[model samples]
Target: MSEKEEKHVIPYINRELSWVDFNYRVLEESFRKENPIMERMRFLGITASNLDEFFMVRVAGVEDQVDSHYFMRDLSGYTPAELLLTLSQKIHSFIEKQYSCFTRSVLPALKKSGIRFLKADELNESQKKYISEYFDKILFPVLTPLAVDRSRPFPLLANRSLNIAVRLKGEDESYFAVVQVPGILTRFLNIPSEGGNDYILLENVIIYKLGELFELNEIRSACTFRITRSSDLDIDEDSDDLLIEVQKFLKKRKRGKPVRLELSRGHDYETELFLKEMLEIEDHQIYEIPGPLDLTFCSSFASMPKYEQFCYRPLQPVYPPSDFADCDDIFKAIRERDRMVHHPYESFETVIDFVRTAAEDENVLAIKQTLYRVSGHSPIVAALIRAAENGKQVTVLVELKARFDEENNIMWAKKLEEAGCHVIYGLVGLKTHCKILLVVRRDEDGIRRYVHMATGNYNDSTAKVYTDIGIFTCREPYGG
Candidate 1:
């Protein structure tokens, strides 16, 4: 390469690799002695699950490019193929370290705090009996076991479905079977233990009773595995009936090709090979997690009521700027002066109250807002409906492409449309990511506009935990 060419080469870390490093920092927090034991465990779980998605969407996309013989290179001068190999190695090492931290460090600390995660073989007979009964009553009815055979084609494994791979043997020959863990049931089932303790994971409970579901004369081996697919929604902007097109695309998301497979490390070699061939995944794509395939189960650690001491102390959200404390009229507060609201630290109720007051106010002319990821049973949606009912002009831009939240947004859009609000399904090509609430009012001077701009969604439930910033203003340029 020429000297000028070498000089122009900027050394930058690939975004994907940098993201893994960021998650490593989160994993490191789990080892901190200062954090509450449960909180540390929560951090570890979050990091692991975050990596899963990163590989599924980001790594999978690069792999696709390499597969297609595309030669595009990144800023670091690494082609897709080169980067995938590098990433796979880096991720393997990172996951190994994460599991070590969890198994070696966190688990012991948790045990000291009297919070225990009982493995499948660790359960006592009484505990086993309780778990078995719970499974029979609650879980057995929901599971579907699919056997791979000449008569039955391989069943479609939906993205992110946790399943059990079973090796079954009949009188004639041996075969493979799959049991999908039901989505309707909780991933972690709390088993009653003495002295306010809890025990269970749906996987272990299922493993204890696999024979009941299979009905096979003999079972060779079974292991838990999960698949993640490329969930990036791609749409042609020029398409007609955008809503119809989006709905069609949403259906395809579930059946998207498996990009990553996570199997328990102890899975038999034959069964692992079978999964690779069946799923059409290369060996490099399979990750052998040491513990449960999904560490998301660790979120259940938050449920132990007796371990309340192993959590962050709760802090009540403060009202913004004390001036609006008694005033039912939000417009009056904005008219007085500009205000800023910090979230999780400041209340989201003020934003809801702003919309609610406008809906109720006779002088308020219209309200316009953008909806991204709103909390379930959103009071904000209800307020907009109420505003429309009061004959105030209401317009809402609902983003239907938010990951894992598309269906909820679609339902909300239909409800908003039915309520006579002018609902827009966001811009043709771009997602309206801005969180904004605009209110128009008629006062003695003239028509005035008030705007609430937020760094986070107007979701009250999340506002209690997610640190975000928002501003309530009626200043000259911003208000106009």
Candidate 2:
């Protein structure tokens, strides 16, 4: 290839940047005053959550290439380091907009609606009393404060967990320590009162009481921060046991390399430098968030039943088509022909019914299914367990490499195995993300097969929100 020809620009938008743009569009919805307040907050939360995963997986990959000295530009024509620098600039701007939308647009609207966010400066005597008591009773015992000095090393921080960085004045020198905000506790705390309702950030409450945690030293300064780590799971299919390999991957993922750091403005400068050097993160990777570190707490607001008036009208999952509406025999309906249901508008019951029907049917011989993710109770999993317990051969490919869902998949896989079903992790070097379910059954004619396939996981809960298409069929091409 000629040098001139090799330097030609590709006529395609970089996918990572494209994805960031998509998330920004979602963030824009929060700026709309006409939209229901809580619903808009959910949009803000979704934006933040999307960015977290974007850094963990997408940005992390680019950084890995740069680290390995692999500078080959993609079709989009940006080298790894160049792309990272561009993405970091875009992200910094995007996050500034998010906080601007929250503080200026959303916060004002929320205040008008009787939801007030009183900061530490605005806390009244009663509010301070409540916060102090709450901290002592709830947060204090769970809080593990790690101080970094010559003798003590910096503690490993979890991916995306919020922490408070504190600078304390020792006898002769100032040092830094971190207090991890308990993830189990709610980030937003409501102060009870009849005059009006108010809430405060959990991190602010801790920052207010840092002296309690570090009584020996004078409190210099403190601010909230969070870090995102690379969370990709590599599957070794060549390994004798794929499930065991996934378990090992899950442990390593928690301690994955730091890809992005979100620090709130106003932390002590020296301590900030201390963290940057200790964590070994580049300048572009550090994000100085203007307001709150995490907006996912806003998404939780959408679930409050009390805020129904401030949210959109609830949408229930619609029933299946008229033909299969009252059908008692799901197997018979599938045997006759193919049936497809559009989820979120229609229902996910058809898929669940197929599995449940097969589980109970004495004529059923075997059930084989690929599970990517499912509901909490997971009727699909329960049905598979029932089938296995009833002496029906059951084979399940549970993809433990499903990002952020490895632990849940691992738990379900063990249950399925204990229930006497054959649970396989999936193909080595590749994640089996395909959603397919097959049930072998005995019919009057001979051995027949039933199949359920979908564009999404068989999670009944998400079916109401995530638009998906699922089909149940007994056709030879699909089921055979």
Candidate 3:
């Protein structure tokens, strides 16, 4: 390598630090004064979600290099350990700024908009009584307290699960126990208020009721904490039944070693020591969050239905092409000329209806598609099932390793297989991220093929929100 290249004098920024800056850009959206308060809150939620994935995949990779003793410096001229230290500093600063934006700008504005998030101490007597009762009646049954000691080892905490580590004083010596906030329960709980928005944090609720959980011991201190574990899937592309292997690894991902620990500040001494020793994490791995352990609850908060006025004006999908609207038969329109549809700007119904029409068309011979990430109740999957049952040859490529969508895709794959569709797990060592659909019809021209292609997934639901381009064509060059 040239000396210039060896010295990394190209003046490029660190990839990891650049990614952290990208997340900060998302956080900056929350600071814009003109944007609606709810939208800003959603932006904050997006940044949090983005950071979670960053730690799971990106940060995990750097940590692996450090663990495996791969000391080679990157093109940016930093060792893995040095890069991690730099990333840690950047992440801490970015997160601090994130919370500052939320608490300073977003929270006060949300209050004016009649949305209120109450802490335990901030609750009125009636509100406190109500919350306490709600906790005893509803949350108590789902709670399990794990005590850490010699015979009874610490429980394996689930990745990203909010938990409260309690320091207790007993007859022998002070010890620590942790209780995970139930995943099934919503993090934000709606409480009765004087006609405006009122809610409580689930962690706060859990904290208030900790005394009941450990009635036998003295409650010295209790604080919320969460951990991010490496969730990157290691797929052996050469393995048989890639679906089964991916499924196997998906289970392992939940138990992957902890990569980042986000502990709510003001942890008791014993609690902090226990987390350090039990998780076997480094000091730099511990992120002392001054605010909430997780900000993902903002997503559900922003989605509250009653106040559309407090959010961005909903943008409706534009009408499909004039040719499709002007022509009675979509197939005839595609065959006559190529067509393009822009989504969020253009309705996805045209695409859905095209498939639906083919399912019912007796002249159609076959249907083929690739599904990566699909909606819960996907109309495309339904139509494919209909086509298969009607004796039309249906071939569907369902990529089972679509990251977080693995379980959902697996379900859809099984359904397609049961419906008699020729379902495949997609090309080995490659994710079928491309969006394509092919249909063959026994027209008067013998066998004619029509294709629908896009730069995005064929998800009708997301089409209303995300911008994408799609085309419908029967061009011989494309079909061939």
Candidate 4:
């Protein structure tokens, strides 16, 4: 309240708002005419994915604070409620900009480049016949229409699952039902085209054949909708077993309170109200997307082989990098001098080979590493298991709390434990974020230690895209 105190408090951008701004900066890449069309679409998808996480974790946390009546102002000097309101406005405007770029710029460019998305009405008789048969053979059998009535409560929809809200005319009165568009199938269906590749959204195909599912009643209206649920875990550090607690939390995460609801543009008013009431969300939380419910699908669509010419040329990293070109032995290369590997430019295989060598080397005594996030079929994890199986001591500190990667890490932890490796589930209330690998070997001189440190996770999948620096050293202080 004092003038001096107020002056000392430097005004800073709110973290939530700053993150949204960062995503907007990413979105700006899509608007650039110089960038390849496919790359621009990929950038747009990245923004949508970023916004989804922002709502699930950041917005959900602030809403929690507001609900608890915690009015304390952040360093940015806005109360929880005020920040939430500002975020709602900022996010709505950001989404509008996202769709504007998609519709005005990306769609036209894609069409010009020989890729097109045809609507239901645009299809010819042959296409319609093909779609109808395809729907019956492929979609009809898999689709389950869940009717919402007093007897049957609204289905507990999973977070982010796209569903169709169908309004049907009953014998007496009208009611609503839900038909989940299966995520298992592809989002875009490639049908026969006269010239270039033409595709139809699976949702549109489903909407066109809704009468098949509801033969008893007349279909009135149907629209695609998706919900983002709160996924930020509330950890109890005092739990008896952190792994089991995290497992329980993971289940809760799937059905956590709905924080965001996305509906197709021009959604029915009655249906929208029904959804809002069921999800317990406000008007600001509801986003009426002008195009698709989720633009994340655009990333995969951009990777089509037919659109390869419109995409940026892929870069291949140099194998057996110059740093280790002189020596065949990885240990000798590190022992001679500290070597650095720049990722996505120099291959990540150098790092994997380092671990594989440690696992296979006769003189190597122990291998230790920290795993934060890894690929589904991680070569690094396989090498660690090999090290343990080779009778060398292997200690792996698997960070189970890694966001969206808990399940994968858990599976790897169990595999490592079964393979006789010592697995640590990280420290309580703190994430093990550092990327480190230490190999102890009994050299002729004495016991020598080699270390591999990096700025990114040991995930090979990400290494192809992320720019990271990794260093291999056998000298003191660093290896210490």
lDDT of 1 by residue, 298-382 (tens): 6666645766788888768877546466665677778888878877777778888888888989988899999999988999999
Could you say which candidate leads in TM-score? 4
Cα RMSDs, all models: 2.6, 2.8, 2.4, 2.3
- Rank order (by lDDT, best first): 4, 3, 2, 1
lDDT against the true structure, each candidate: 0.83, 0.87, 0.88, 0.91
Q: What digit string (tens of lDDT, one per residue) describes model 3 on residues 329-376?
A: 888888888989988777888899999999999999999999988899
Off by over 4 Å in 3: 1-8, 476-480
Clash pairs detected, candidate 4 = none
Model 2: lDDT equals: 0.87
* Positional deviation of residue 81's Cα in model 3 after best superposition, in angstroms: 2.2
Q: Is candidate 1 or candidate 3 better by TM-score?
A: 3
Task: Give me the overall lDDT of model 1.
Answer: 0.83
List residue ranges in candidate 4 displaced over 4 A: 1-10, 476-480
lDDT of 4 at 99: 97
RMSD of 2: 2.8
Query: How high is the lDDT of residue 85 in model 3?
Result: 92
